[model samples]
Target: MGRSWQGRGRGRDMEYDKGGDNIGGASLKKIETEKGVIARFVIGRSANKGDSMDKSIDAENSQTDDFIILDNVVEAPEEASKKVKLFFAYAADRWDAQFYAKANDNIYVNMDALGSTLAAHLGKPRAYIGCMKSGEVFSEPNQKWYEPEWWKFGDKKAYFRHAYGEMYVITNALARFVSINRRVGSKKMGFQERTPLMVAAMYGSFGVLTYIISTGRSDVNRVSSDEKVTAHHCAVSACFVSIVEVIKILLDASTL
Candidate 1:
């Protein structure tokens, strides 16, 4: 007699087969926010199964007409791209604002007095003040008075005082630039000489004034040196040279 299929538990076997089919049907889902689209793919346990599932999933999950995919990666739309660009642009602008704020603070701290002197002398309706750090004044004849005469015989206090005198001279030169230009009735002027004022103020010498004026840079019209005329000695002339170069560049760019 042949064994009955039912007696062999074929009904239980069918139930197990149905459960296995349910597991194979489980899928991984991908959703795109912008397009409001959903993609579903079957999950597989083996490499071959995974490969088959990938092909099936890709076919079922193809991008809609409004969306695009390149090399299995989503590409941003024009609007989204524009938004990203705007975000970076805003960030850069904010950074620049912060940088300028810090720079203005530094200018106020170190160069406020010098700036004020320049403004007063320039006599322009408006002026932008800038600062530079200078070293000891040059030893040239025009710069001798501003340069310390007795560097070899000073204590620390005397040395510091001498240095401060040089700083004052530099400030005076900046002031002189403004004053001479204003007197000439030129709002936009080129470089001018402040060496005479610097020399007379520091060394009580009027002869150096003629020498500085001979250089053909503008000189203050007043020839007499008295209480009203004062000069500040500069310790380091190199600093002025650099500042001049920077100003020239800025002026040229503004013209362009």
Candidate 2:
């Protein structure tokens, strides 16, 4: 609860937009005791990534100076691993902080509960808390989640699972680890068997579908292996989240 911020990869500063705790209509029980923060509040400014430091959004807590920010960054978990490395590489200004936590939007964190959990590992300099998940990687070429330099694990099932809606926490030390030391690998181009628009329509990945369509890369009219099956066909076939929205997006993309 100090200054808010925005940031991207390492060596850049971030600035957070202050809209109070409630965003849109979804609000969380306002947190009082503070140790960690919502990762979504973190953001970046400035085109120049040099000096790696910039400005901070004025959060509620004026007395304490804990939170920091960054520069230009993609959406979460895209360059997320790099964000971790950047935070760690950064030295605290004016004060000493024992821990740095990562939390973001779509969460209602009990700061008291989180504080107690973090207290147990207070003295340990390099302590890690929360769940660390793998096998979260997918090699969708034109998709945003694809990381070309995935050298953390051997082959498939290497990248940490990325759920855009899923909110979790992590410590400063661990986030800097593999993100900094991992090697880079050659990205092999492969043919996509199915259309993203079709797949997104079939499954209820509203965000992914919207992004793909916005890029104008998805061929909504393109048929699948069956040649007769189009994205519209898939949208109608699946009774998942309202097909109306998916169809609307497909139709809109068609006009573009």
What lDDT does the true structure give each of the candidates? Answer: 0.23, 0.29
Query: In candidate 1, what are the lDDT values of residues 116-214, reduced to their tens digit?
Result: 233333322122223333244444456644444545434331222211112222223333443344334221232221221111111111111100001
- Tens digit per residue, CA lDDT, model 2, 70-130: 5444324335444433433332221134444433321222333334444544444444333
TM-score of each: 0.14, 0.36
Off by over 4 Å in 2: 1-40, 46-69, 72-78, 88-94, 136-157, 160-256
lDDT of 2: 0.29
Relative to the true structure, candidate 1 reaches a TM of 0.14
> Which 10-residue window of candidate 2 scores lowest in summed lDDT?
206-215
Best of the candidates, TM-score = 2
